[model samples]
Target: MTARERQRWAVLGVAAITASIVATRSLVVTDRDRVDRFVDAVSGEVTPGRIDAAMRYLDPDRQPVEITAYEATEAYGPGEREALRQRVRERLRAAAGMRFRVLRKSVTMGARSASVSMQLYSSEGAPSAEYVLRKHGDDWLVETARLR
Candidate 1:
């Protein structure tokens, strides 16, 4: 190829590589972002129904992450629902509007599935919990969460 043609090809190759990098990064779900999404759903104004809405962020179909009790929600009594929502809200609120750090994170990825394990702490440095997340249809869902 001529020098001019070689330059053009090099430019196109660089562009393609850049695009591939961006696409790969976008497709890989970060555990920190997963917890952030969960916080977003439960952050503002705790409501009885909000817990159920936040539950949608969880992927309960996978083993080790799925618990039957959480799996069979949707018929919670008013008081029970409110209590759950309040507890979640309080946890986030206590951690300064959910401003926290992922103390540790690990990810295992497949072509269309992934698992994440993470330890989190509040901004003030209190242990929050260690949990698992699973990837589902371009979204990361909480498989399990526990308090420390």
Candidate 2:
């Protein structure tokens, strides 16, 4: 091929690769933001005593489930849901001296819902906590937590 033609092809190839990279990066950032927003909502609920606002993210019919630090490896169920929520609130009140904050978050989106994993920081500046969230419609709710 002519030198000019070869150079043109190389430029086009580079442009295509750059575009793909940009698109992929954009998607990753968008996913990250979604998780952040969801975590923020949860934090707001806990901080402001807005349990109703937090419930907006939960599947009303699904019920809350609790998994303690000892049972962190197990799945949560309705039987322990309410007790767990109360325990979390008490712990935050006592240990953190404040409500939770989302330190980092990751999310995966589905057709109409999403799931998030979040690292949460306490008010007392202790090690971060882990929370798993599931989106219900447009809102996100905590499905489980692993406290530190």
Candidate 3:
């Protein structure tokens, strides 16, 4: 082969190897990691004025979200997504300066679903919650959030 041809082949080989490495790195994100990332995003989005942004993490299909407080519980399903959103908005407005964080977390991952149990901390109180996530296409969506 000519010198120019050899140089071009070497460049192409390097490019191919680089692409392979990138793809492999992307594929190495395990289910647990995906759940953590999703949760982290949810945590960051739950601000006093970002109710809509926070709700976006919820499944588009309107999976149920169970909220428990003061020994009372309510389940918000497809027909009650708006009510759920309204409730969240009210809480966010009420706790304007409170910070929300996950103090501890445990993850159980299935092939297409995962459960994350998290101890949450906020100015109001420390509560434990379980979040269920389902794989939809290439993304993970919050199927349910049970707050205690």
Candidate 4:
């Protein structure tokens, strides 16, 4: 083969590899966005009276989990989780008439599981907390949460 032909093939191979890398990165970003949307829907749009909406994002078989805050750790069951959601709604309503804003979200996908880190701001416009979400099958549930 001619040197020019070999050079052309090398260039084409490099271009193809770069394109594949870009496409794969785009897919990862898209999946992360999906997790972000779910977090946004829970923290931004959900309210006290509409706390049930948050359940859609949680795994159906989600168990009670412990959330460690600055100086305390609280274990929450399904009912307590609902109550916490309501309290969040009420606090949001009393503070700003809306839910908190999600500052950032990072999602990592694994072979059979995934983890998400979400930074949430309080309705009072202060740093509220960071929640770690775990994905089981198609559902994402809060596994641990801590205040920033």
- Top candidate by TM-score: 3
- Alpha-carbon RMSD to native, per candidate: 7.5, 7.9, 3.8, 6.2
TM-score for all predictions? 0.41, 0.46, 0.68, 0.51
Worst 10 residues of 2 by lDDT: 52-61
lDDT string for model 2 (1-148, tens) is 9999999999999999999999898767454466665566666325534544444444424635444463445444556555545655565554332566666766666654456666666655544445566655444556665655
lDDT of 4 by residue, 1-91 (tens): 9999999999999999999999898766444565666665667744543455555554324755556657777666765756665544554
Flag regions of model 4 displaced more than 4 Å: 1-34, 58-61, 77-96
Clashing pairs in 3: none
- lDDT string, candidate 1, 1-148, tens digits: 9999999999999999999999999998765566566655543434545556676664334322432222342322323544544555564444443444566756565554445455555545544443455566556665555554
Candidate 1 total steric clashes? 0
* lDDT of predicted model 1: 0.54
TM-score of 3: 0.68
> Which candidate gets the maximum lDDT versus the true structure?
3
Give, for candidate 1, the lowest lDDT window spanning 10 residues.
Answer: 67-76
Candidate 1 all-Cα RMSD:
7.5
lDDT of each: 0.54, 0.57, 0.72, 0.62
C-alpha lDDT of residue 10 in model 3: 100
